[model samples]
Target: MSNLAPSLTAARQLADEYPNHKVTLLLLTDFQLFDADINRVLTDIATFPGDVHAVVLGGTQVDGLMDERVQITKATYTDPPGTVARAIFASLVNHRPGARPI
Candidate 1:
């Protein structure tokens, strides 16, 4: 989806439906689609019970996007498949335990 808020909202709603399980949201993006609408969703996501990890493709890291609540990794589309996978894996491994990467 082009809009980040709606996608994240839907994910949050889906997680709400299954209250017994912890949800993990793996958001892969190029850091190019966000607008003002994402701010509110970010606020909500801060309190979300599940884990949120953003795998930023193309190495285009957005300023102010990294916060204590969300895990983020920077990888390039030009990188080899295994390199990207290792970067993602390392990021998740360093994240808090019990989170299932999506």
Candidate 2:
């Protein structure tokens, strides 16, 4: 969602600070340079102590889906923001049981 640098930094910090907490990151933006950075972040998060889940909303190509520890969701701006959020939330809740925040 944020720029690559901030996103990575935040993810690292969160993973470090709250190792026992479940962490989910949502990246929603458009950039051709995000692939490598996102991959690195995901790798780091997966190695963190807690459970880390990431949903990438605007990626073009993803190479690691069978890893079981990380997930990547590629989405475009084909609908309104509200619709997009709903869809993302639905998918997340479906894939990750008890992930929805009420």
Query: Best candidate per TM-score, number?
Result: 1
Per lDDT, the best of the predicted structures is 1
Worst ten in a row by lDDT for model 2 = 27-36
Q: What is the per-residue lDDT of model 1 for residues 1-102, given as tens digits with 9 covering 90 to 100?
A: 345777777888899999987677777777676556666766765667678777777777565865577877777857667765765665555545775544
Query: How well does candidate 2 match the true structure in TM-score terms?
Result: 0.50
lDDT of 1 at 11: 86
lDDT scores in order:
0.69, 0.54
List pairs with backbone clashes in candidate 1: none
Q: Write the per-residue lDDT of candidate 2 for residues 27-70, one digit (tens) a residue.
A: 45443444446666555545655434444456555455324665
Which ranges of candidate 2 are over 4 A from the true structure?
1-3, 34-42, 45-59, 64-68, 79-83, 87-102
Question: How well does candidate 1 score on lDDT at residue 71?
Answer: 73
